[model samples]
Target: MPKLTKRTIDATEPQVVEFFIWDESIPGFGVRVMPSGRKSFVVQYRAGRRPRRMSLGPSTVLTCDQARTRC
Candidate 1:
């Protein structure tokens, strides 16, 4: 799987849906977009045998830049 780059995030509904449907190989990132058009970032990765996941918090509360820093 390729490393997730900042350029990959969609920032819009149509692109977000396409990303999930088309990009299934990448293994380090997930997203939660809100009805108000806010997006929350998540980190998904494997640590040894277990799958590790972390929530970077809500987008409105934490900017996209801030979310990346948390990861």
Candidate 2:
């Protein structure tokens, strides 16, 4: 996917099924487009072999830069 930018995020439309658009530059940093048309920033990583996913917040409340920093 392309770099996660405000433009890209804003341009993303929700699919029939929920999916994620991952950041090319930052591992685990991505945006989730839900079927309900909700977009959210999230970070996925492994914590001691167990996978973990954390929602940073809704895209409305967080910027790409802010979400990247959190990751």
lDDT of 2 by residue, 1-71 (tens): 88888999888888899999999999898999999999999999999999999999999998888888888
Worst 10 residues of 2 by lDDT: 62-71
Q: Which portions of model 1 miss their true places by more than 4 Å?
A: 1-11, 14-27, 34-38
TM per candidate comes to 0.50, 0.92
Error at 43, model 1, angstroms? 0.6
Question: What TM-score should be assigned to candidate 1?
Answer: 0.50
Q: After superposition, how far is residue 7 of candidate 1 from its true place, in Å?
A: 12
**Residue lDDT tens for model 1, 17-64:** 423211244446556555545566778778999997676775457654
